[model samples]
Target: MTTFTIGDVTITKITELEATGDTELMLPDATPQAVRQVTWLHPHYATEDGLLKTSIHAFAVVTPTRRIIVDTGLGNHKMGRPVPAWNGMTGTFLQDLTDAGFPPDGIDTVLCTHLHVDHAGWDTRLVHGQWVPTFPNARHVFARTEFEHAEAAPGHGTAELFADSVTPLVQAGLVDLVPANEQVTPEIQMVPTPGHTPGHVSILIESRGERALITGDFIHHPVQLARPSWTSAGDHDPGRAATTRRVVLEELARTRTLLIGTHFPGPTAGYVIPDGDDTYRLQSLA
Candidate 1:
């Protein structure tokens, strides 16, 4: 279990699963030769052969006032995943959460960065042939634009995701639709960082004087931090994703804020250090 704290709030990384994906697939513009040039990526983010290492994990943010879960990872017993491996996945995610000291009923809020298949899977669980909210007592919060955009959005990619993981929460009156920049709590706020999805946002956590940003797929891998232009395969809008990535990086590098990538591989939290005029490297906090 990896954990970090900013002032009074404590954030822990509870991993649901870890796996390696094709580097070229993760960054379409990245060639094997190109990736090797970025020496900083090896040993953690990528393999010697350029396979991109990644993890599906959730951040449990425990504030003095609220126990919030940011981005539930790909859940168990889910189906209709475009990728066969993610479909019908079974893991000890809840047990892992409990092991980390946050119980299901103890979670006060579920913050979804976006409704992508992997990010929002644990919002609900299947029981007795029915879908139900996993966190019986927590309020599942989603960006209003993101919640509405899923309805008219093309493709059935997120259709099963909505029916199984999201709609059930709404049916249970556990879903709250807020603006993209909604202030979740006194120390936690959502930053409108679109491009991965229309209403995609990152969690900006501040308390006392310390700050950290939970990047929800706005930037998937650390490689993008260096190139700042190599887009993810799952990006809804690669061009806009790249643009937003650069802007986000500037702020992260400028202030050296702690960055936690939702899908980043080993040691997910880090600081963006300026390596050159246009290059930034992830200096892991581990």
Candidate 2:
């Protein structure tokens, strides 16, 4: 379900989407309305507001020595979600991972860009109604600050989501709560790109002069390449998220860094390119 290799790193996109009904998730002003314009939505997706869709993707980063997973998508057995699509259900993300040749036990590290439902879903799995780490041997890495905040606001309806997907990993001794800016490896560095979450970090990979930035929910669609200020309603801090998006896009556009959006449609892997006069577009790799 995921794409692979911008340079040397191998990426696998895992999906748990039940449908592809809503097509307009990209907006025109997004690059310039996000999800409203750049998105290739069908006629049905058009509405008074904008496009909307729900296909969750999780990325696995396979290196020479380490098998790392970035952002575990929506998992099974989660409760209290608004949508019936993502609440208390079973899916095939793990099966798809194995089909992609990465079994659950093979993952050495679980890197959560942030602790949202879609981003942190597969950290654990259901075993006779118990939440267990999907990757039994892997260390679940999360931002200490994010975990704290989510923990503090337990009854605010977000508590159960984090409790099932995150807290159990910590209690089982598989969690590695690191500082916001901790560098997991030479090829991998966690840049503290807060706003989405207080400790949200984007994973950067540089090898043989080739660099790829796994943009974990920083900007959802290609539209953000142009209008970096259009924060999604889901962003924890819209203003800060917009600011981070602008800064990240500016640098990526300037440096021509390769990128992979965790939620981008079709070929999720691509690069942010200057379209014209300060505008930008996403060029996907085949």
Candidate 3:
């Protein structure tokens, strides 16, 4: 239940899953030797054997005005998911959230950065054999453009995801489809950082001069922070995703702002500082 406070806003990392494996599998472009050479990533981001530590988690953003669950991790009992391990699986995501002090009903907002399988899975839960919204009292927010794009151009895992995790919320009439860059509250707003998906966006939290950006899927791993041009294979548009990463990373480094990457493992929340003119490093706040 580690939490970082920005002004009055408290952001907690509630993990759904944690793993350590190949960095090259995720980054592809960055081989073991290349990644190992980064030096700063060792003992935390990478193991002695060269495995990369990764976490699939959500940021429970507790603002003065609202309790927002950002990016629900891969849900349970889901089927037809593209990833073999994610298919028909179950996890303790909700119970973990409750244990962290934010119960399902207590959450006032569910902010999804995008409609990807992992980020949107827990948007709903299995209820009496039916998929339903887990947070009964929350305004489940999504960007209209992202939703529409996911619906019309569903890809691997996207169809099943829309059918189970997303559509159910829409049917429940709890969905708030706002403009891609709309602000949810005084302290919370969306940043349009597409390329991960057609309308994928990142969440920005600001309060009392302090700031942090929840990097949805814009940049998957810390290596990408150093090698901004290295895009994920899953990226909808690798080129655009790389572009977004470069711009966002530079701003984060220049401003010395806190970065909470959705899929970042080990020490998740950190600051991006300039390593050289063209690259940067992740300094974990944990």
Candidate 4:
């Protein structure tokens, strides 16, 4: 139930799952030897044995005029997923969100950074053998390029994801395809940080002179802050992803904006501090 206040805007973490080790599946280059080199990662982002820690969670963002849920995590009873553990997940994600004061019906917007399996799984739920939109009253938002790419050639397990989670929303007329840089609200704007996906976007929240950035997949682990060149194995364009990471880290570090990592472990919010000429580290806000 971690929460952060950026002026009048409030962002709450609604955790669905957390795990350690098995990072190589997402980051092929994040070997034990390589992860151990970043000393600051110990105890939170990584273990002493060099296993990376990560979480699957959604953020409940509350502004003066809107209640938004950013990135619904892997859903329950999802079949044919590449990862066995991710399939048929029975976690209390919706209950957790409700307990945190953001119920599905109460959410006015469902903002997906990208339409990946893990990020958009909970967009729909299985109801009487049919997939249906979970947030019945909220508008499911997606980047136009992302929606088109996933529709045409959904990669790996994404074909099933689109059919069960994404397509249902579109069929229900609850989807809103917008540009990558669409302004969600006056205080919440989408920051185009592509490469992880063709239309990947990070969220930017600014209000009353305070600011924060919710990093989607462009920067997976805190280790990327130290080694900006290390890209996720799932990245659509590794080189471009690395470039986006490096550029974003520099700007965030310079402005000292609070960085909220979408997959970052507990104590996920932080300040991107410049560690070296071209390297940075997250100074945990927790």
Candidate 5:
């Protein structure tokens, strides 16, 4: 139940799905030989098979003028997820949103952190056997570069992510693709944190004097905070991802700003701290 407020805005975490996925391969730099070197950081994640959990977190950004949702996690009816649990299945996502006291119709804007499957899942829903924007009256925001990547349809890693989660939004005319550094509101702005994706951007919340960053996949897990080089196997550009990770970690450490990681353990909100010369750690906040 970790929530934060900035001026008139109130942000709450709305979870859609929670399950462990192939994380063992993510360690030792996703190498075949390093399989045995993997270990779980928490007993809750029983096995080392990546020992990671996927959470579809929706950040309900309640402002005086608008109710925005930053990152809509995997929506229902998504196809072609490597993991069976992520594919064509009905979950309580929309109901959960309403349970949290904010219905889909209440949302004025839906901001995607990036166009990854998990981040863009809830962007659309099944309607009369067709996919449609889950947020009917909302303007779905996306990065122009991100949409292009989907338009190109690269290959395995991100091909389906766009075809399923993003392209449909464009078809519906509800999407608003902006420049990488576009600012949606006075209290919110986008920071160029590409690497995970070509136009990946992290949302910055500057209200009053406090600051917070809604990190999409700039760094997936807390372990990345300890070893910023642990790039995800799904990264479109590993080298660039590493560089972005280092830079973002440094900035988060310097500013002592609160960060919200999409797949972070438990509450998924924390601050970065220096572990050694180049390593850092995630210190969960109150």
Candidate 6:
């Protein structure tokens, strides 16, 4: 388990799945030849043969007054998923979260950066052939725009995702549809960094003059830090996504904010540093 602290706030990673290679499905342009060119990616974000290493996990953010889980990973027993490997997953994500010391009942807030399949899968669990809220005591928060968009035009495996993972929370009256830039807490706020989805937001944590940003899907891998123009295949708007990437990276580099990638593999936290006039690299904090 990897953890980082910003002042009194503690952020711990609870991993559900991790894999290397086959990244081309998400990033078509990230071929082995192209990925090998980003020298900074070697040994951590990328393999020797040039395949990108990625992870699917959630961050347990504990502030002085609240405990929150951000972006729950692919939950177990989800069916009809587009990705064969992601379907019918039987991982010990809930136990893993408990072992990390942030039990489901202890979490008072469940924040989803966006309503994507991988990000919102664990919102509910199958119980006696019925879907139920996993974090029963917590209020599940989602951006209004994202929720509406996904409801109207569900994206890859999102139909099943909504039927099982998301709808249950709404039915139980545990969902909070907030604005894109709502203040989650004094130390944690949503930073509107859309384009991966219409209402996607990156989380910002600030306390005691220290700051960190939990990147949603706006910037997937470290290679995107170097090539901000490269966008994921799942991007809702490629042009806007690329623009957001460039702008976000510039600000991150300028402010020297600790960047915590949502899907980044081990050594996931880093600092964005300028490589040249227009490019940048991630200086891993691990």
What is the C-alpha local distance difference test score of each model? 0.87, 0.73, 0.86, 0.91, 0.76, 0.91
**Model 6 alpha-carbon miss at residue 243, Å:** 0.4
What candidate 6 gets wrong by more than 4 Å, as runs, is none
- Candidate 4: which pairs clash? none
Candidate with the greatest lDDT versus the true structure: 4
Model 4 earns a TM-score of 0.98
- Measured against the true structure, the TM-scores of the candidates, in listed sequence, are 0.97, 0.87, 0.97, 0.98, 0.88, 0.99
Which model is ahead, 2 or 3, in terms of TM-score? 3
- The local lDDT score (0 to 100) that residue 163 gets in candidate 2 is 75
Instruction: Give the CA lDDT, 0 to 100, for residue 223 in model 4.
Output: 95
- The regions of model 4 sitting more than 4 angstroms off are none
Predict model 4's lDDT versus the native.
0.91
lDDT of 1 by residue, 106-134 (tens): 99999999988888898888899898888
User: Model 4 over residues 1-286: C-alpha lDDT tens digits?
Assistant: 7999999999999999899998877898899999999999998899998999999999999999999999999999998888789999989999999998988999999999988888998898888999888999999888899889888877768899988998788888999989899999999999899899988999999999989999999999999999999888899999999999989999998887999999999899899998997899999976
Q: What is the per-residue lDDT of model 2 for residues 1-286, given as tens digits with 9 covering 90 to 100?
A: 5566646677777776734334323232432144456443322222335544334688888877789999888888888764566787777778888888889888899898877777777888889979888898998888789778767755434577777887788788998888878788767778888777667788888777788888887777655675566667666787898888878877887787887777666666677787765567777775
Q: Tell me how many clashing residue pairs each candidate has.
A: 0, 18, 0, 0, 6, 0
Write model 5 residue lDDT over 111-218, tens digit each, in one string: 887766777788878789877778889998888898787668655435776666666877888888899899889888988898888888999988877788988888
Q: Write the per-residue lDDT of candidate 3 for residues 153-178, one digit (tens) a residue.
A: 88978999999998888888899989
Q: Determine which window of 10 residues in candidate 3 has minimal summed lDDT.
A: 22-31
lDDT of 1 at 53: 84
180-209: candidate 6 lDDT, tens digit per residue: 889999999988898989989999999998
